[model samples]
Target: MIFKRKSSATTWQEVLEGCLRRDTKAQRQLYERYANFAKNTCLRYAQNEVEAEEMASDGFLKVFDKIEKYDSTQPFEGWLKRIMINTAIDHYRRNSHKISWSDLDEASQVPYSDSYYKDEHLVNITADEIMMFVQRLPASYRAVFSLSVVEGYNHNEIAEMLGISESASRSNLSKAKAKLQSWISAYVIQQDEITHKHE
Candidate 1:
């Protein structure tokens, strides 16, 4: 017999109903459905996997506790993701920015310069592969870069949310871009060498 893949229907109404009835299976199903997104949110704010897992656990507990109050009209993942992101933000805020990271504030905010990456439709790699390079960035730079590039948050908004000056957000984003550029360049060179050898 071919088994159907299970994806729990996670409408807010369903989840809320489950939570109200104290159904363990519903809770488990809810966690299973959003665990990956929750983990990714934790990883964005955490320095390592250990912290990320802790954040994920803490976030899920919060979700269980608060599910009853959720607005059913809104997106369920959006609600779960907000809780996860808040959990990560809490962890990050506790550590505080390092005093030595003064360079974070050294640059002025420049409008994100559009490059060939923007004008040309050339991306030789998949989003998953690009994310590999992104994950290697310093935590501050990664957060700022992800916010600006992926989330499309401007410097002022990111700075407000991150508790940094606008200049600091911009500086971190610049450093992050430089790092990604260096990584992509190296990868391109390696690809060329492998191709030439194959010829």
Candidate 2:
């Protein structure tokens, strides 16, 4: 029912319309365009690049399979991102039984000077490194962190999505932040020492 757009520079709206009509080329084009975005979303939740690839593929399949349900008025990229995030959450739910949650209240309470996060050494850190740190978090804490900080979901929203209490969601986010802060601080200190030694 859907025909491929004639121009190579077809707009996303045209692609969506074509995809709605089940155009194969349109589907392929859409996947190609957004695959990296999906992979990045998956990377936030997956432990490694291999798992992130799997999650991205599965999420794309869902996106195509459920394309008919997509509302045209909404931002298409945002819709796809939600699907990718949900796919990651589903993956987490399946494997989370193997992971345990811990209370890190002391870490959470550690006060840092205002300049701590602004260290020059941190500028050298890549986005991938930051994502790796997030990926290294325990399943529950990672989920809460991704939802709260990356996806901008509040505690109530995260709790509803994860079937946990709001308090638990809040707790997990706090602990995740605390852990990341400590890890980054250590990394910065190491980097500073290395720089000084080289100097």
Cα-based lDDT for every prediction: 0.74, 0.82
- The TM-score values for the models, in the order shown, are 0.77, 0.82
- TM-score: model 2 vs. ground truth: 0.82
Model 1 residue 161 CA deviation (Å) reads 1.7
Task: Judging by lDDT against the true structure, name the best candidate.
Answer: 2
In model 1, the runs with Cα more than 4 Å from the true position are: 1-12, 43-51, 97-113, 119-122
lDDT of 2: 0.82
Off by over 4 Å in 2: 1-11, 103-124
Each candidate's number of clashing pairs is: 0, 0
Q: On a 0 to 1 TM-score scale, where does candidate 1 land against the true structure? A: 0.77
lDDT of 1 by residue, 171-195 (tens): 8887777777767668867887899
lDDT of 2 by residue, 33-120 (tens): 9989899888888888999999999998899899999988888889999999999888877876876654445435644443544676
Error of 1 at 54 (Å): 3.5
Error of 1 at 156 (Å): 2.2
Q: Pick the candidate with the highest TM-score.
A: 2
Q: What is the lDDT of residue 81 in candidate 1?
A: 80
